[model samples]
Target: MTTPFSSLEDYIALPRVESLALSPDGRKAVLTVATLSTDRTSFDRALWEIEADGEGVPRRLTRSAKGESGAAFTGSGDVLFVSGRADASAAEAPDAPQLWLLPSRGGEARCLTRLAGGVSSIAATALDGETVVISADLLPSSRSIEEDAAARKRRTDASITAVFHESYPVRYWDHDLGPGVPHLLALETPGGDELPEVRDSVETGRSADESRGVYPSHLTSPRDLTPTPRRSADTAGQALTPDGRTLIASLRVAEKRSGRFVLVAIDVASGERTSLFDEPGVHVESPVISRDGRRLAFLRAPFHTADAPADQEIWVADIDGGDARRIATDWDRWPSSLVFDRDGTNIIATADHDGRGPIFRLPLDGSAPEQLTTDDFAYTHVAVDASSGDLVALRSSWTRPPHPVRVRADGEVFLLATPAGAPAPLGSITEVATTADDGARVRGWLLLPDGASAETPAPLLLWIHGGPLNSWNAWSWRWNPQLALAKGYAVLLPDPALSTGYGLDFIARGWNAWGAAPYTDLLAITDEAVRRDDIDEDRTAAMGGSFGGYMANWVAGHTDRFRAIVSHASLWALDQFIGTTDNSEFWQTVFTPRGLTENSPHHFVRDIVTPLLVVHGDRDYRVPVGESLRLWSELAEHHADDDGTTPHRFLLFPDENHWVLKPQHAVVWYETVFAFLDQHVHDRAWSRPAQLG
Candidate 1:
């Protein structure tokens, strides 16, 4: 029997469930499932509903060509989501994503907002589900939706694609910041009943019935909550109190050259704002309100300097920002996301620990964080059931993509039946670790092929993780080692120096010296992996993306042990990267100029002997295409033969961003990478991908 794991085409076609949303009543849950579209060029997402108690099979809730995402349940159990699907009732359907509602009493979904720029995201829903807050893009100078639309049309008519910037970061990871800034807007919904006529001419700026179809008479106008926002609400983390009277959010406060996020509470009705937790050199984000809306649990991270990196501390405080104190102070792991437990006495959070992301229960009394659900999987989108106190989250690992699961209060985890299903088991994963020369511990996950054994050793692929700060703890669709395992290669996913799962000290070891400890740590872990009986040390290659790509470049110059090296969206030259990257100000402040030059891989390019493959997307504003272009140019300048040829390759995706997102592009990315590895490591002929031709 052939499994999807053995074939790239089959693997890409498998249905994937990525996020989970639980109803307030805890009777049902909704999941966001991604499946390959009929065209196979893109993945379309849809919402699915399942029994929260695990009693019934999952049922499809909503479907459309454009698909639905950002699924959240209103207090009344009505599902609210963002979709760009056209509405038959409207004269002209929205082309951009708009807020939609799926009534709890069972009816067809309805369009809720038709902003010209579309709804950025659904922020929060009131307890009764009447008041809803959404994030939308508005022109900084526009006073109303009509004016914003007019301004946008004017730009389109003039064919002006340029963005005027007054801020430090003009672009984000993959796109320009904009002619418009994100603002929080609050609106009122009628739940299962009909909405009232829209008021406030400035809010809607038109006859509601003419613009909005069907329920125009029932829907109220969306009120601008952050009227004078200056990009402060861009990608802000917000939570609405159970009473829906106030909204707690993390707004970016722009500094001279950098910015720090501070917590703020906004009165939903009056649009009044209050500073909650503001501290210099520190960021307060990921705010979560208690079930009773009495307390707040959020993450506090101080800015890192060139000398040292700071830890992210979990802080608990009163709803009004009084008597705030940090909890889990002694814990070494850094939490990524958190939520208040049903009882409000403990905070349920997920953090990278050792080599896995596990859920931890941090008591308010501050004894220690209790580890829950001992497993090899990482969890996200965790929601606590107020009635049963059970947890529902999306969990995944190397063996599986994200799937919905229910976690009991006592720590038992049960897989919920998902319509998306699971992929075929491909490889066995084991933990690998080694001690650095400095006596510090380094660890990673090693994925082994099915036939890997002492008698039948497998070639090794030493894959590095991107976030110099990230650990290889969760399942990654973009860089799945399971595909490599299926291709009969043993993959070494190392969490070297600067990885999060380890203590702050481990990160500080590589603080300003990126090429030193991190590079050596990768080598140490690789050395340990290649020593295993089922690994062939002679046939090995190194590959990474982003920061990992930088390390790949570093490894290529520092050692010829790996037969081939692949770097994607990498930093070949440190100084060039720091200045060109979107968040230059932050990087400039974090690393000294001397440190950037000393650790730069470009300086040592003349020493690289291994075959190199550089992959980058032109739209990658984070790393930028210039990094790869310079690396390629330098490789040619120093290593190219007189015939104008070299043992190197560059794969560029003009439409892609920091990552190769489109399905076809992703396939080509893997094909090119695999071909490069086979050509150099296995001594096979280079095969050009047909798609490129």
Candidate 2:
């Protein structure tokens, strides 16, 4: 049978690839496709290869059941990609989807490392046609989704907040020493070890089940890997050496909020390691050695402090270790996804310093970086031909979908192909700046209802994004402002105080000051939106999930400005959440040390006035269903008051987790939301059926 959804547009719109990597020769480009299942079927993902100059239709190179895409070309013509599948018996098992190999020129795909485990990270450089330097992961295994789904719902023997954590870490490759791989070496360092398996919970003295976080460890060469544990070195950055000798990595031993890291160089064969320069004051990010492999260029920034902006500087250090100097000091910039031109003369990196990421070129000798594009979009992803240095970058704006573009050295830009299905021209989209109660001017991008006029008030939806820290940009996508705009509602997203992109301080302000500034900004935005002559104040509604859900909950309790509210996967009870959710680290760092207090949401439940339709996944592990249940249960008790009576409803998607990943669930979701919003915000009247018509 055909799917219930009518058009592919509704079922799915955009191609699921968010990132891409080009082969050194730039003859082929790899597409990293992350797919969302149609139902609770199998989560499928694959890597598709396309010709660099728009000469080939994208062809799927691999069929993967558990999502395999980080595909890239080696110095040799051979291709290396992260290929794996879910352990049919476990969820994120360390023993599932071991590393595999494939030819760049298409041949048999073989399992390279049968360590019988999943690899979180992989780096490959061709020494010959058959050899490549690689890093794979080995972690403690857990039950698979299917296996866990097979079990009956069991009550927990103990109480816990954060649940269902999978702590998988990447380990460097040395012992297996894939045959003939050049620089096939291991560096001496610390950290990156598998945690002890927890057979069962010993609840009394021990708490609930939890995954162990990564620790500082010594990276001893295979010869010394046994345990004369030297100084610690930990890094999540790709563990690769260009010249194939000195392995450069960052150590995560320091206690800093910025996740401060230390960069150290290790001699793979000798197991001897030395700190390039201990960046104790802050953190150092991914370091890229020049193509010639003589110098290391990495981004450095101060540690994250409560009230400070993490200033970042791009610094280049000699491989032999000395004369480390800062080259780039734009606080607004950082090294984006990096790709060096195969010749190694110029380093290519993407930057979105001003909301739109354009490409920038940094010389190997640490000269000034030249901006490559004028129109903002993400220039961070580029496919530069190793042979000619001809660059192909993906660009998009709020109004534009990302499409690959070709840039010639002469400075001319050529469009490769329109994004798979570009949206029809937007009738009218304008940025609106509105002032809040505290005189804070919030900015928002407003998409107008096609047939509506300023004289005629339009139905409006004030959509709030969950990461309250995340900012709303001009991007056409699913479940975003586009969905509501197409449904005929003017969608408005306010760039409230705590939103990102403004600076680090603005983001940090969002921590413990949740309902304080954010709530205030939301109310001011709503009131300002209502004041506009083109809006229908009485027909307005609100919707958001996670942090957005918290806003909806708080708005309902404090104001009657909104007719209806939609809360999805939200944290409603801060008091209970600190002690109940798995986000205690965030709570401790961002919120308060004292935990939940008497001023929590449950204690202030009397403030709610607007009706709410609470939606959440039954299997959500992040913010458990317990939070939703508590909010809904409590809101139900106060459904009516002296002022007026409002209806409240609850809907749960079973088997779905924090993210509603299935297409079927999305269809059901949109329909339910439309029907609910119409019932409340439209203020329509209907007669009941009488006398059995």
Candidate 3:
């Protein structure tokens, strides 16, 4: 019997499991699952617990309106999570995310700490878990929590909404950064009636001397662990030692020339900080400390510039900052989600291979890395039990959503949890391979609708992945191709040049030239896919977002093979885009005017012949809305001389950010896209989406 997977409505309603965390004793595991709310407007996440031995059924642990996430375990086996739920006794802010603790055996979770600014992240020691470190936002002028609250009240009473900027990067991907600076605080919790106390450590606040940098003091109870005048240091990835004495974190230091990240260790008692690893133009991130507190493993990559593309490698070093070396240097794929085994002799990590994200074990003794997983499914948030050596991860594929699974050391994989609801039956997924113009092998995934065959062919939809630096190796909720398959159309997902999981040499081919090998690789793979008897070569369309969107625009201008093209949040003019994008500083460092002029798609817009649909979000600062605006204006001007019957449209989202997040908005996006494709690719009558009306 075949599984059931239906339309977009059914697809969005499926439960999605994001992360997995195992307890210190390795007896239980907690998984974070997100499901659509009752109103279907957004998703609400909750923590679920399962037996690590795969003996007990999955059980829901915490339930709240605001939802709980970022689950971590203490040494006592109690689960700690962050949530925005209010506390009646402490009069906590309703929107601030506070730390909550759930007892090891079984009991109601209680609030652990209440600060002016909610906690963003938490890390604990593996030995006793008595010491915890949390990152929170603090206003510059406020020296205490009460002062911070008063400052906020005064601003609200005065109806004042202004943010003073003294540094770069005023805004991030989806939110504004200002008014408050991020600070790290250490807390001691004994797990009893005794309340947690903040210890005096590093000093907090900015100095009056402008030359020293803008380090304003804020609500630092004890003190700040990292306090460098004028220079702002951000804590990205942090891991506490087993004894809770030293904290190792990836610190991004802002400089005049460029921003670079280094791994540093901070003493919990004396607040002394020492740089463990620092490179001139390389960034170190995702630091994971061993249980014995002897080694550190992290991923390092070159600082991305127009001239340089990111190529990641795994690095291992002694905790004392000695014997540092890079491992898996010859590995083709980029490693992520680093975790060390119980013996500390091996490091477990995940990387995209071909079209799947597989788990690999790299030995510390310089042995060849061994592939632990052999399947078409992708895995993430991997955790290994120290006692049993068994693994638990969230696995997904093109035909399936994310779910919890248990993999034994002997290569035995078992599904731990299956969501309750049933989705409509999906089409078959197969591998497609071909050789590029450079004689390099390229691979992709093809989804063929049910009943498709040589006699009964299906229309093709070429979907390019964003992050020209990323790969299509995992299941995606936003850019899902299953919905298109449900409409009787086959979808092709290709990994062209610049796509990760391939070696660094493959990415260098398209480093500064967006219209070169990457484009040719895509075309080569597409040609091989359409040659299949089950695919209808004449009836095809192309679509992509971000970097993929840039490719979509380039494909439309360079070729007339496709009937229609959809470009979302794409870059049209290289010169204008480089200056307006949120990352202008980085772009200015690596890109030159000459190279941009030669590769920009806007220079060749007049050659376009395919019908185009442009989509963008006003809040997308990464690739500003102006790119879409310019592309639409040029397309309109080019088609103005032709018959006014040309079907070209623009879909704009005012409230959405880089990605379409709202449930209703996502539904509308798919409806509009499918309707446009049906009209141009299938010769069907035009139908306006009901949601638009």
Per-residue CA lDDT of candidate 2, range 387-444, in tens? 6778877666666666666777654677663225455544357667766665556676
- Candidate 2 worst ten-residue window by lDDT: 173-182
Candidate 2 or 3, higher TM-score? 3
Off by over 4 Å in 3: 1-5, 92-94, 123-127, 190-223, 227-233, 304-310, 418-425, 641-646
Q: Give the candidates in order of TM-score, highest first.
A: 1, 3, 2
Q: Would you estimate the TM-scores of all the predictions?
A: 0.96, 0.74, 0.92
Kindly provide the TM-score of model 3 when superposed on the true structure, using C-alpha atoms: 0.92
Cα RMSD to the true fold for all candidates: 2.7, 10.4, 5.5
Q: After superposition, how far is residue 326 of candidate 1 from its true place, in Å?
A: 1.4
Error of 2 at 533 (Å): 4.8
- Worst lDDT run of 10 residues, candidate 1, spans 210-219
User: Which runs of model 1 end up more than 4 angstroms from their true locations?
Assistant: 195-218
TM-score of 1: 0.96
